[model samples]
Each structure stands twice: as structure tokens, then as C-alpha cells.
Target: MIAAMLKVMVLGVCRDRGALAMAFVLPPLIFVVFAAIFSGTSGTEMRLKVAVVDEVRSDETTRLMDAIANEPSLRMHALANQSQQSLREAVAYGNADVGLIIAGALTQDGEQSPIVIVADAGRSMAGPILSGHVQRLIASQLPGVALRRLIPSVDMLSGGLTSQQRAQLISSTDEMNTADNSKSITVGESGAGLFRMEVLDGRGNVTVSYYAGAVAVMFLLFSAMQGAASLIEERSSGIMDRLAVGAAGTDVVVASKFLFLTLQGLLQVGLIFVIAWIVYDVALLPHLMPWLATTVFASAAAAGLALFMASACTSRQQANTISSFLVLVASAVGGSMVPRFMMPPWLQDIGWLTPNAWAIEAYQGALWRGENTWALLTFLWPLALVAVVSLLCAFALSRYRLRLG
Candidate 1:
């Protein structure tokens, strides 16, 4: 029975170049786009654009600016003669990440003055990182120069302290800073330490993992929908009418489509992961079994869904529209577009209705979260159940529709 279904589907697919292209070409292209967008997030270096305005241009300020410019992480644009207003505008208008203005001289006096930093609230990390580097530079020049003044706002201090109290505070602050500076995290010879771990291991580009699942589920539905078009076409062209009267039953036709789409969906998903492994270096080999299991169940679920949609709709246009709408809505709610963690609690609970939610979760759990095959069955069984129920329903509906016609 399955062989007959496979022969028909294979012949149909081979005859249509467009269908073949969508099945093979589209998935790899989609994976490439996703990999390009997310491949750099987990790199060791953080490249930030910084704008500097040195009004004083003293030896101290020049040295400090030079030091900051030399850092590997920072890409500095020296606005040598530019005003502090220009620096502020640069950061405000997205021209630069963080801006520094050295308007006054770096005095070696006992009192500390604030160094102006131009930043917006949206990027909280850039400001603090820039400030830390600048403080380190200041410390190099003027030893024991209190970095407390580098805090973003003076309002953080509720009241003024006396000179003696302030001196004691500075001493405590200096001791704490020194203590922190003295220690560093490094890999040990045992090979189990933090530094020994691969930067890409377990923590590689999260965006890639997320989009891998998202695109897989999204296109699984698309390919299945496209495959299911055969049903609508056959029905409209009187082929289904002949088949209904012939020895072949409506149940056989539905079963054939379900099997065909399941196989194609599996191929589409497997090709996508292969691209992910080759292009993005995702850890596919270590968790191959879990991934394959997830793919099989996901493909089955998507196939059943496509058959159901095909049977339910009277026209090809209606089937396409309904399938497209359902796929997108499910993808959106199912953590295919956005991570479920970002979604509200109520929406997260509701995502389980969609096959995409289970498939994506299962893939993510196996590939990214290092989940075992058994652990993934929690999601796998539900997906298989959905496929079984949906395929049965589609067969019944197709039989009923054929009889009515």
C-alpha cells in the first residue's frame, strides 16, 4: 500500500520542477539566511563603535584615549576637534555606541570629578563596558584615583560625606577593586574548567538554534501543504471521481498522501539540519538519533495536518489560504517566530495546540539542550498522536466528500 503511494508521489514530484525546487532548493537557502544573521553572536570578541571628543587634548587625555582605541573590542572614531554636543548626538542618533568627552584636564588632585559619558538607556551594556575601560586607563595614570565618580549619576548618593568619611570610603572601595582585579578565571589542567569549554559548545549562537527549529517547522507545513495540493487538483479534474468508483478506496488515497507528505517533510527537515551542520557547525552528530526521532514525528504531524486541510477545503484556493493561515498562526504562537520564554505565560500554555510547538521544542531540547532520546518522548508521543488522529480524520472526511460528489 505504501509502495503504491510512494510511486505515485515520486512520479508526480519528478514531473514538476517547481515542486522539486521548493522541496530541495528553498530549504537550504532559508537555512543559509538564518545562519548568516546569527553566526556572530557567540564570538569571543565584541565589536562596539565609540566616539571620542578630547577638548583638553592634554598628554594625560591623549594617552587615555590612545589606550581605549588600542583595545581589541572597541572600534574608535576619534572626533578630535568635535564638540561634546556632537559626541552626545552621535550616541543619541545611533552614530556611535558610547561617547566620551574629555572637556577638562585630568587633575591628580585629591578630589575626583566625573568624566562625561554620552549614552542612551536602550544599550545598557555599552555604557558600562566603555566606562570600565576608561576607569582602568585613569587608574593607570593616577594610581588610587577613586573610580566611584565614574558612576552614571551623582543622584545615586543621597547625601554628602565628610572628608574623613569619604577618605575611608575610598580606601574600602580601593581594597575591594584590588581584590577583584587580583583574581581571574582560567582553565585548569584537569580539562573540566570554564576556560577549557568550547565557546561554541552549549552556548553557540542561540539565534541559530531558535531559527533552525522555527524554519524547520514553518517549511514542513509549507511543503506538506504544497504536496496536499495534489488532492485538490485530483478532485477538481475528476481523477478522484474515477478513483472513488475504481477498486482503490478513498482511505487508500488519503493514506498515500499522508505517507508521501510525511516522507517529503522528513527529507526537507533532514536537509535543513544538514545545512545547519555544514554552515553553522551545529552539533548534529552527537545527537543524531534524538534529532531523527524528532524529525520523523514532526514530519508525520505536518503530513496529517496537510491532509486534513486538503480534505476539509472544497477548492484549491481555499485549501491554500487555510493552510497558509493556519501554518503562520501556528508558527507565530508555537515559538517558531519568537522564543517561548519571551511570550506571556498564557500564550505559552496555548502554544501546545500547534504541532510546530511540540516539534520545535523537541528539536531544541535534543540539539541545543543536550536532552536524551527518552526525555524527548515527552513531546514526541503527543506529536505522533496528533498525526494519527489527524490522518484518520482526514481519511474519513475524504471518504465522505467523495461519496457526496
Candidate 2:
């Protein structure tokens, strides 16, 4: 009897192809995505987008900029004829992960450092990584600059080098600069001190603002999916058939569901942000208008996606399983689970396909970065497009494909 029951279970499991795929296929696929996202976090394989401005334009600055531009791990955008303000804007607007401004001579003058690293507080990790690369480049590519800067302090401390010592020191410095010392020299923390970091939009709680948007979009997708699953239940129970023939036909049912789910998502996101505001001081009240606009579009997109998933699936279980897989994958790639900058270049590019990325960016722009109306539109339109396209697709699948009435 036990063996017969076991056989029945095995056969039943094998017959359900969706369950089988969900149990076996999805784990490995999710592992691959997680591995791809986390594999480069150890700094060796990580790549950063750097926006550079050379204000000094001297030989040293040119050499340093050239070295940085050639670095394999960094994508450098040299903003020629641009100011430090432009670089700051680039970083603030997510055009670059970090900004580099060669504002003074490479050799330190008094207490001021020459290199400036401008970063958005939301992406705080990028600033230090860029600084490390700059320090390494200065030590390797222009060892003479390091040696020249050190010599002045040494001379002042040692009561000045004698004429003969000075001559020999000059010759040795030139030799050190000309020789291949890439493998021999290492820049320490003191060398890294040559960089000054200027972080933007750090007054508010940056982490809360960023992850609030992330969690909001993710849960919006999930809640919307759960609510939309009722369509499948209604279809199976003959409720949809009954509604199809009534004065309020299938169109009304679908439209009403869409409206309810959208509003539900909006309220859900509002509750999350309201808590964020009360607890973390996330500047919600200050940016209420743009924030509301972003929330509405994001909710509509979630509703549309959920409806489409429901309309396409034949069973509630299948819809749940598939929606879970898709939502998890989308959240992982779309800067919800992790910042998009942390992912590789390919994954970062793919993130644009997910509504989470657009919604998160729109919210961040509205709350954290204080982006202007025109700039916020760039992130808004994609979300609106997703909502429209998905809603249309859901309508078509329900009306024509399913033939409900």
C-alpha cells in the first residue's frame, strides 16, 4: 500500500510539468542570476562608470586622465570643456557612477588635495572604488609625481638637501619615473589621501530612500499578482462565464479588476512611503507631487503586468508559480534586490527592461535627487509605456484569445 501511494505521488509529480519545472529548473536559473550579480563584488572584476573633468589641464593632469581612461575596470567619460558642477550633475543624475575632477596640481599644495571624487550618496560605494583606482594610477603611471611631492617635504624636514644630494636625487627621481615600477610600488592609505570626496544629496536618509523605492516596486508587483490571481479563480468557478453574459460583461469585470488592483497598489505603496517618512524622514512631503505621479504610474504598470499574467495562464497554481519566478528574476535584475551599479555591464543594460528599474529611478529622482520635471519624465514615460502595453495585451488575451463571451 505504501509503495502504491509512492508510485502515485511520483507519477502525479511527473505529470505536472509546470510544478516540475518550478521545482527543478527555477532553482538553477535563480542561482545563475544570483551568482552573476554577486561574483564581481570582490573588487577585482567590478567595473565603475567614471565621469572626468580636467580643470587643471596640465601635463600631469593629462597623464593622469589618460591613465584613468585606459583602465580596463573603469568606463571613463571625459567631459571636456565641462566644469566640476557638470561632473557633479552627471553623478547626481545617474549618468555616471562617480565623478572625477582634476581640480588642482597632482602634487599637493599646502593642505588641499588635487583630485576630487564626486558621488551620489545613494551609491556611496562607488566613490571609494574610484578613489582607489586613482591612487593606484598615480602611484604606477606617474611615480615621479609621487616622488616629486615627497621630495619637498623631505627637504623641508631634513634642512634641505645639499647641492650634490639634490643633483643625485633629481637624477634618481627621473630614473624612477622612467623605469617600469608598476610591479614594485604600492600606494598606501596616505597616497589615497590625495583624493577628496564630495557626496551629493546626503542630507536625508539615502538608504531608506533608495530601498524604499526598491521594496515598494517589488511588493507592488507581488501584491498586484496576488490580487490578479482571482481572475483565474473566477474563471474556474464559472463566475467569469456568468459575468460575461450580464449587463456588466467580461469587459467591465476586467476593467474593474484592473482599476481595483491599481488603486490597491497605490495605497500599498503609499503606506510603505508614509511609514518611511515618519520613521526615516525620507522627504516625502517635500516632493509630494512628483512622488504621487511616480506612484500612480508604477501601480498601473504592476496592475497591468499582473492582469496579463492572469489572462495568459490557464490555472491559478500555474499563474502563481510563473509569476513568482518572473517577479523574482525581474526584481533581481532591475535594481530591486541590489543596486544596478553593482551588477555587470550586461546585467545593468538588461535592467532597463524591468518596470522596477524605471519606478525606482523615478522615485529616487523625485525624493532623493530632486530632479526637475523634464528630467523626471525620462523615467516616467517608460513606466507609462509598460502600463499601456501590458494593459492592452491583457485586454486582448481576455477578449479574443480566451473568448469569455
Highest-lDDT candidate = 2
lDDT of 1 at 289: 95
Instruction: Report the number of clashing residue pairs per model.
Output: 0, 0
Q: What does candidate 1's lDDT look like per residue over 1-405, in tens digits?
A: 999999999998798665665577656755653343233222323456788887778665676677788866667865534887677655643456677766565543223332566654333356656766665554553333334332212224746566776677567645543452433222122211101111112433445765787799899998898898788888888888988878997888889989889889888988888888888877788889999999999999999989988898887866776676678667766768765433433455677888888988788678766677898998899999989998998998888888888
Give the lDDT of residue 120 in candidate 1. Answer: 44
Question: Native-vs-model 2 lDDT?
Answer: 0.85
Q: All models: lDDT?
A: 0.69, 0.85
Query: Per-residue lDDT tens digits of candidate 2, residues 1-405?
Result: 999999998888899988898888989999998788778566456789999998898877888888898999999765644888878888988889999988888765567778889989999889988888887887888787677667666788999899888778767766776676755366555663578888887447889999999999999999999999998888888887787778976677778888999999989999999999999999998888889999999999999999999989888999999999999989998999999988888888899999999999999899898765566899989998988888888878887644843
Q: Which ten residues in a row have the lowest lDDT in candidate 1?
A: 191-200
Instruction: Using TM-score, give the best candidate's number.
Output: 2
